[model samples]
Target chain A: MPEKRQMHLGQQLTRAGRWSRAGITSGPAALWLGIFLALPLAAILAISFLTRGEYGGVELPFTFDSYKRLAGFGELGFDSLYPVVLGRSLALGMATAVLCLAAALPLAFFIARLSEKYKGAALTLVVIPFWTNLLIRTYAWQILFSPNRWLTVAAHSLGIGTAGEALYPGTLAVLTGMVCDFLPFMVLPLYASVEKMDWTLAEAAADLGADRWRVFRHALLPQIWPGLGAGFILVFLPATGQFVIPDLLGGAKTAMLGNVIQQQFASSRDWPFGSAIAAVALLLVLVGLAIFQRKGSKHEVLP
Target chain B: MKINTPLLNRHFCAVVFSAFLFAGAAQAEKSTLNLFIWSEYIDPQIVSAFEKQFDCKVNIDLYEDVDSMLAKIQGGGAGLYDVVVPSDNLVPVMMKQNLLAPLRHENIPNLKNLGEKFVSPAYDSKNRFTVAYQWGTVGLLARKTAGQPLPDSWACIFDPAKSAGSFMLIDSVRDQVGAALKYQGHSVNSIIPSELKAARDLCIAAKSRSVGFDGSVGVKNKILAKTAQVGIVYSGEGVRAMVDDTNTTYIIPKEGSVIWVDNLAVLAKAPHRDLAEKFLNFILDARIGAQLSAYTQFATPNQAARAFIKPLDLENHAIYPLPEVTDRLEFLNDLGFKLRLYDEVWTQIKTR
Candidate 1:
């Protein structure tokens, strides 16, 4: 009987060891993703299939009505309003990401080339704006872009906009806010790649008689491809769902997918519809990431 | 002897004792009453008074719009807040969804102080669900420039030719659409598809020539800052803005406007139902009602409270509209399933 008890104790110790190993490996991550991400996503997916109740709550009996509404079929006939908004949102997001990348590439290189002391200060400057609330910063932009402000006056003098008119509540202001808000996201990641880049390949390209553009295309671009991909994804995904900048700076004259989803949840009180929009947004982001990954893999054979 | 059982037992007893103490402390902390209300709608002094009288904590939470308030209560906040203030138009919606509890009228003897019209409102005809807290009108606020005439009609906003200068449209769906409806000689609460389409078109046309949409407070700020010459705003905001800057004046359009009443109601599954009922009763008291109106600059719906209100405030026509003007105003009713129609129309207007 003592031998049997000793064996049982040994088995319990083994079980405990296995559990501790698993806990060390993937426990916190699994628990976090399970609670915060997976559970909410599952709830949204389920809600997307449900029907809106008489007074805005969800009803149990499943329906595909929300998806149908999102597809532009509504009580007022086949309206393409939602589809138009979605297209506009995608265009705005792509524009913002492209603009950020264009600005960040040079800025990232400049910072990466700085002395260690200056490099820390430069990066700190890039992140300092984040310490202030985004809303307050956006409001500051509104004041600067007002009709009588110096910025608007300068724009008018430069023949960019009509005299005595605000330069905001329009596309220019919205784009400016989006680019300013997302530039850091692109800069930080691109700087990481640039800082680690080797200069020998670029020198070799120049030695091989390649021009400046060719040197960047073949040698420099490949070295920073990973960071570019990371920065692009970071900016593009959040920019796609950006509603606040457009709402505040662009005067809310038009609706984006984000704004529409928000309206469904807040103003319309239709959670099912909001969930459907969110589900579609998630799918679109996943597809985008997949395409990006495929293109990125092709560049992985770089020297 | 090897185990040290007495020492282990003492440690275990201490842990159990502390756990009990924590549980008791948590029970003692239950005196907090959670109140969900509109921002700047209550008097802080009155809240402190209620807290001191009851010897409990009053935790205030604010929401800017009715739909957001409804969303919170529906999305698991029903039991989190003891009391909520919803607009009259939303009372029926809350009632239908069972988000609000039936008020115990006997527990609230101060209900007799309310005006007869508000005592049995159309939204809560039996007075079963909600009690009126304050009432206001949605109207136009125009900056009184040196030479510009004050806008007395909705046409000043809807028609570019009639506008004195750049104006702002209200961002809220009901108020903006209702303004358009009233401009076109339709009821502010009209749910008819054809009428709503016309209103949407009018709003879209107005959007082209105006500074875009904003909340009433935003419009008031714009007017105060001289950024906008005119805008649709709530009467209370207009009155307050007029006080700050004597250059702005509010007018209920000759075509009429929406009269909205915000109500204080207990949640159906409120954790502190008795305390919430007591709060409702306390707020309904004549002096408290007068104080709330004085602080918020909104017209009280309590008849008895009028006796306690300052004569100057009672005489302010902007706060208390004339009977003729009040007759022109219409209250918005719950659209039920037709609400989707308004939502669709609003989306079209915004997109256009």
Candidate 2:
């Protein structure tokens, strides 16, 4: 009986030790997320309800004027400016994600099919652009696309653009910049999924009389959906809030949601309004993530 | 295992002694002054010379515009910086907001070297809170096309029919709206709703024809690259572009424009107030002032620095305008609450 009691006490101590170890390992990450993410988000929510001070600071009195202003109801009559900006941002983001996916799908598959040595080299080449600053790269594009440059001359000769006209500061230039900036984000994750794919399953689907498109849809796509979802989120979220690409390439003729929020904070000095915009953007992103997750889980339950 | 009390006490004593030593070293390295100013406005050589003379390190931070600078200062950056450079119009706004500290004239003996016109400027009477650093006028930078005459008035850019080739509007709210107001023969600082509405309409009409809004420096680059034929730019940027390419010219429109002055002032809650005052005095020195003007190619407000300036630069009308040009220039004033009218107008213009 005494021996049994000793073993039980030892087991209890071991269980407590395991619990303490787990707590110690996760403590720092939890603290980091609490301080950096959760606290700032809470602060933004609080500031969105506060009133703007006379000198561009926050005041104690709370009001919903910022939200009202965002909804097209300002001191002036109702206007569709803010809503238009939001819609434009959404369109830009969707276009960028779709373009990235289209370009990345084939490239990722090609990389996955390469020899082991070539695969590493190809991945490195894909990520090499990140070593240089994004601003410098964008400026390089401006130089290349200038009216007097050889590329523009070739484009003009090929009847792609008007004679003596630069191919930048337009929608085409903005789209080009956005796609180039985000392609690697899509390609990396998609490549991971493609590399782990089983060819036997695809062949079996084909042998079962499934056509090319049907095989991909029934067999290959479900396996890679997780990585595709991740890559889509990675590209879409940042592309929506991207300010520099549009400002530089689109010539600032139109303001995106990112630009509007930035102007409120940096130029207008309206913290409350900026916070309101940020809060709304965060809510939109969360809702999108929720819907995506629900769809992804439903796919997982299949087969 | 037996506890070693004496060994643990020795280890604790050694750690405490090292901590004290580190604290002393940190105290010894505390002689740094933080300066926040506009990008490309100050010469690096001048900053290094000041550091050498004072035997202390200087930390520099750059900003692109007045609004961003003010936002940073108001966002709990009060004590983080020792000095700031705010535009003349913003000096009054900052003063009213209690963002600037009063100047201790005794520490800045070089104030006497400033030109008579700038000594007691409207923004800070009797030089109470700020000192003039560099001043320039908003104007047009136009390329010299073969058969087209140079633009002489703001109407050339404001009127779509008269505007030639691809042009760029200034990306600043006050300057852009002011250009339209001046084109209509109204005050650049007009707060009247009807006048502002007319200005907004004019800008929207021009925007349809122009390339789009960009900073003065960006406009200068566009002119140099031959991407644009005309752009609304500051005098300094225009001068720089002309120096780069002789075919470009800077002109102050006949309809008049805004003259702006950037001032160096200490922050209200500065960590190094005395050091900041010394730095200001050093910058105001005659030779240093000339070097600064030469570097930035902007007009100097220092009377004593004239003798030190290069002969060609002193004679350049683009750098230092003639009396006739000066007569047509108006300084931007602090419009107080009326400033919101300009913001509203700018929003409408940008949205359209």
Best by TM-score: 1
- Tell me candidate 1's interface RMSD: 1.0
Off by over 4 Å in 2: A1-25, A301-303, B1-30, B335-338
Question: What is the C-alpha lDDT profile of model 2 across B28-114, one tens digit per residue?
Answer: 665778999989999999988988888788999999998889988988899899999999988887887898999999999999999
Give model 2's TM-score versus the native structure: 0.92
The CAPRI-style docking tier of model 2 reads acceptable
Once fitted onto the true fold, the runs of candidate 1 whose alpha carbons sit more than 4 angstroms away are A1-24, B1-30
lDDT of 1 by residue, B268-305 (tens): 99989989999999999999999999888899999999
lDDT of 2 by residue, A38-123 (tens): 99999999999998766577887899988898887764457767777777887899899999999999999999999998999999
Model 1, A1-303: lDDT tens digits are 534533443465567767876798899999999999999999999999998887888888999988998898886778988878888898999999999999999999999999988999999999999999999999999999988789999989999878988888899999999999999999999999999998899999999999999999888998899999999999998999999999899888888888888899887888898999999988988998999899997775256
Query: Which residue pairs in model 1 clash with each other?
Result: none
